[model samples]
Target chain A: MKRFTAICLFLLSVVALATPAFALRISIVPDHGNPASPQMGDRLRFHTAIQNDGNAAQEGVLAWISLVETDSGKEQPVDLEDWSAHKAVVSAALLPGQTVESIWPMRLIKAGSYRVVVSAMSRSGETLTASPFVDFTVRQKPVVESSRIVPVALSAPLLIAGLLIWRLRENRARA
Target chain B: MNAVAVIARKEAGDLLRSPRGLSWLLAMAAALSAFSLLLISDAELSLLDNAEAVYGMCAVIMGLGALLAIVMGVDTVAGEKERGSLVPLLIAPVARDRILFGKLAGIAMVWAAMYLLALPYLWAAGGAGQNLAEGLVSLALLGTPVVLGFGFLAMGMGARLGSTRSALMVCLVILLLAASPVILGPSLRQTAVGRIFDWINPLSVALNALDAVIIDSQAVVSQWLHWNLTLLFSGITLWFARDGFYRTAL
Candidate 1:
């Protein structure tokens, strides 16, 4: 009975040590000094570092970024289609203790408080790891964007109409 | 060349002097202005990417140009026939094909003028965006062939049918069919038939090229295939117009 108990304890300890060897971890940092408050239309970039924490080689690992609007009355995930065209990165293989870094560039389109997170998962493994959310506020500029466009938009047609009228008068004179 | 030039000059002058033609040009400018103002002023629309706005402008420009071309085309032979001027024009020194070419050249001048008028609006929508220049170039490269192709095709129909109403009806149907794919949802667009039609459609090719050039920032060289297809479409339509006009009974 004593020998059996000893064997059982030894096997349990071995299983516990082997678990982390097959895992992956990811973390994200702002590429530039974190602008806690960025202006709308400002370009933002993040650096995501994905490392294999396992003793074995990691294969077919995928990393992607997610953005969520946190300050709206309702929390909703933002579509990154316009924000960043290249949101996902894939690694064919990552050896033990190897780190892969990817740069994600996005244009700020909306003014709101938001959080960005990077997540990674291995195709062969069931475990998924995500980095802590990085928070930021996007401020809207007060400038009236329409004032500049209205002049040109309204005048172009009037100018063309004037030309048309002149041409009509000329044709009538010729007649 | 001189005969073609003279006829072209006459055609252009006639179009410019006509109240109907001048109205269309004025309408185009007004439409573009309204569109630009809406894009910049609307709450949701104002937030869109500059590239998206530019793309919208390109589409509107192409649509307006195509409409003008079709109107002129259906009127090319049929209008003259109605006015009892076809016989005199046909008896001139130029061949029928050359006359058709001259008419197309006149239409091209108006389209060029339309393009020039749309530039300030394009600049306003693009707003110092890097895609503005590329979008302009793509519009010129792709839009010319596609817009003129509609003109030539409509003129061919008018030549063969000798009725403006019939030709206009046929052109509208073709335009609706060609433009239908663009209105369909993404899932529908992914279907086998849609994919095939998109690859062969001149309008689709031009839109795709603009999307690639402006949104994707792709090199113009990469769009050579689309350019070739649009050119080929125009070339075929021009031939059909020439042949139809050439074989017409005076």
Candidate 2:
């Protein structure tokens, strides 16, 4: 009986230790991601890695990416109005102790500050495993930058020249 | 030459004393100054290419030019008649066509002043060299046609109407029509009707040409059709003025 009891205790300990190793686990690892700033009109990309830390495998996983813009003097998200680049990627399977990375491509049509939201989810019920927020900046387009500065540069001197010419013409008229 | 120049000189001299003309100059200067302050305050503008900046500024000032055309020309003949000052200008020993052209010359000075006022800002915005000159010349070149188109229209309408209030109302209505494309969104403006209207509006055409040249780097020759329409309208309006003025009960 004593030997049998000791054998039973050893079996329970082994099962307890092995059960956790075989349990299902999913996590998002922030290894390599998108760059900090993207130029205007560039097709920006975000990289995501979904890792299965558990010994058991997960099948048919999903990843969602979204861009939220914040402009000046506005608390609410401005109507997308025309931007329609949000998308989701589904994987066939995530093996035990494995990671799957994806590249999400988006075109930058407008310049502004944005936040990228990445979500790792289950394909069956849209259950989220991990959610991460990344900050992003899109610089102004070349045309836009020029538009803002050129007029002022050219106009200021022209203003002075106009005044002088007017004065000169007025003096000549007086003479 | 003497009659037109003398009349133009006299009209130009009178404009110096005109409160409206001086006020317009003040307003334009203030706007340019405000924009200059903004540009000088930022490091971001320095990073832009010279050509890009010139194209943008050209679009804005040209719009303002359209406004100036209305305000200045709206009163050239009609308002003077309304205020009982045309008899002196008309009774003078000069041909009616010379008088009309002379008055146009006076307004041309105003256009020159506006363009001169714009040059410094362009230089400041565009930086030095061929890039700035390209923008300056384009704006200057387009400026003449814009002034002539709207200026002649206003003068002809004023002479025909013989009342400042009536002429102003009509001119504003037409101005609004011409400005429709600019007032609407890109998607809306691209619709079939909007496209036709934009093609018809001289201001829209000149602005479009400016964008094509300064922004898209297209050839100026491609804009000849719009220029042709613009010149034709200017000529027709001048004819209307000559016939209409003599017929009016002044």
Candidate 3:
């Protein structure tokens, strides 16, 4: 009886150590169809996946998303408002062997390359972060068409003013 | 010594009499007031908001205050020389070190006076309900090193350049240095270049120290390392200013 009890206790300790208290996995899926570009007033979509890797259900998963600019090896936080994208937070309970997906709608208002970082935190204080930075260029649009019209618009007044000044100078010299 | 006192009094008198000096002071006051009001109004918006608003307010106030110090210092030496008044003072028996110390003392006094005048408004703003005493203590303690550092930098540049325009440019450089963290904080967190910038920049240190005080209520010992670094920088700059003054014809 004593030997059996000691064996049971040892097995229980191993089982306790093997069971994870809490585990989480996070990932960002970028969509090529709605590729993120550095164009003002452009919209894009991405998907985020969260999974519970532990044996038990995890509660209070709060998520946040931010766009970061990667430049000169630096990660700069791009203002979501300037990008015309709204940041949203969602909470859900994830049971073991279950996963949750969040669809993020992002708009690019200011032209720049950026990385989207999504973070999720559990009520028990476990946190996971994933970032997918996309790079693209934006072309500037002209205010008005036809460069030929620009010179005429700019030089007409100058030509008239120059002529008037020259005529005055000549009249003064003749006087 | 009475010589230092006399120089201090003279510098203070000149600062008060100059229109630029008064304008600088008013500008500092205005900046502080605007920041304080923004903090209070922001805080009143949501009770759930953290100490971010307070930190922002304190940072702006300290930044503007540092700028004002630079302005005052640029005029302290370079402007005087440009106007041809520095020659007569240079001829006097007063030690060059004393003159420099006197200038620093006068500028510090003006900064402190402006800071004190702005304190009430700060208190009435967001600082009233949340760790007001601690904030004031931190302000008084940490503010000293920052103001001293900028003052030394400004005076050194002014003495070396001997032209207010050049001095102003130097002041702008220092302002850029001080404001780098705000401009670069986001990008630096992920890049090697930003990491190096963060380590070398005095403005970054100042802002971090202020954050600790306002947010964590960390003790002065926690900030001693940064304060020591700033003091060392100020000492080196002051030494350089003295050496430059000795070499210059004034």
Candidate 4:
């Protein structure tokens, strides 16, 4: 009888000691900085921080960059071409209430308004019940381009002058 | 119905039916096209991808508008005299001043046509810009008056000269005079003459207004002084052109 009670107590203790995987609370801080308007084809860097606020240590976490649907405002599937970093990140013993910083460097491939989402998830497909996401938007670059104006400004006068000079010479020759 | 309307329609018809008019249309079509300019850069092409590129197109419009005022004004009075087409029109019951009005109205039609040709390019060039619609509006508000000033000046010179060659020379001189301030280096633009010219020159005024509207997105009130000066210059030049045309009509 004493053995039975000891076994029951031990099982209860063991059950109580192990935290359910769903109990881990993870969150990310949204960070958007300068050059929010990026030119097309420009390499861009994004910085974010993830925190594990629950009782369990989050392991084999990967920071993913995703495109948010412009109209639907929903996250698209992670794309390699659209993002910079694709590797899973393991936190250094990020126990309960510990934090980790992450970076995502990407190149802008197309020109249009874009909203990007940064999500941190556990590597083991089923362990994490919740994930953290950081969202931000950037506008197309070269909105105020003026380089092409230089040649036109200079050449317009020269072309007009040349035409007038030639016409003047033609008239003199005729006379 | 009215003499001005009648004459304007005839003039428009004449231009629309002629080879020179078709050529001008084609040139304007090509000039306002962004595809050619976009090809020059080989960047991913979008309507508003390179907003600054459209300014080159605008500059072309302004230059062509000036050239049109000058070249067409050669047909306004001096070319008519050279071709002996003026005497028959002078005998009509229309007032000599009305004849001048007809000419002005005809030029206005041509400008309106040019503006229509340019509208698509404006959309493609600076569609994403702040206050882009206002920048487009500046064409009507500021561009028209600038063209009027040059048109009237050209007509006045053409009336007095009554010969295409001399009038064209004078037009060239006027073009140089107006464009000189533009050709002046930035260092020169800081001087007193440049400052004064910047304030008064119609082309500068128009361009600055567009820059303020499209690029800077400022309120129209800030450009009021420059716009006012442009309109005033236009009115004065038109009045002078009418006087010259009246005297030269007989």
Best by lDDT: 1
Candidates arranged by TM-score, highest first: 1, 2, 4, 3
Once superposed on the true structure, which residue ranges of model 2 sit more than 4 Å away at CA?
A1-175, B16-19, B34-52, B128-131
lDDT of 1 by residue, B18-132 (tens): 7766788789989998888888666557775678788888988988888888888778877777778888988877776678778889778777877898898888778656678
Docking quality (DockQ) of candidate 1? 0.20
The TM-scores, one per candidate, come to 0.68, 0.64, 0.56, 0.58
Please, what are the lDDT tens digits per residue for candidate 4 over residues A57-103?
A: 76666555566435355435435544454434555455667677766
lDDT per residue (tens digit) for residues B93-124 in model 3:
88877877787888777667656655554454
Which pairs in model 3 have colliding backbones?
A40-A109, A73-B191, A75-B187
- Evaluated at residue A1, the lDDT of candidate 4 is 100
For the predicted complex of model 4, DockQ is: 0.06
Total clashing pairs for each candidate: 1, 21, 3, 0
lDDT of 1 by residue, A76-136 (tens): 9999876888889999998889999999888887788889999888877776789878888
Residue by residue across B1-250, what tens digits does model 4's lDDT show? 9898888776665554444565555555655443335524443332233434445456557767777777776678877888888889999888876777888888888888778766655665555454557666766787888886787888888888787788889877877777775566457578898878877777877777766765666776788887898899889989878877887875
State residue B121's C-alpha deviation in candidate 3, in Å: 3.2
Give the clashing residue pairs of candidate 4, or none: none
Clash pairs, model 1 backbone: A21-A54
Q: By summed lDDT, which 10 consecutive residues of candidate 2 chain A come out lowest?
A: A22-31
**Which candidate do you rate higher for lDDT, 2 or 4?**
2
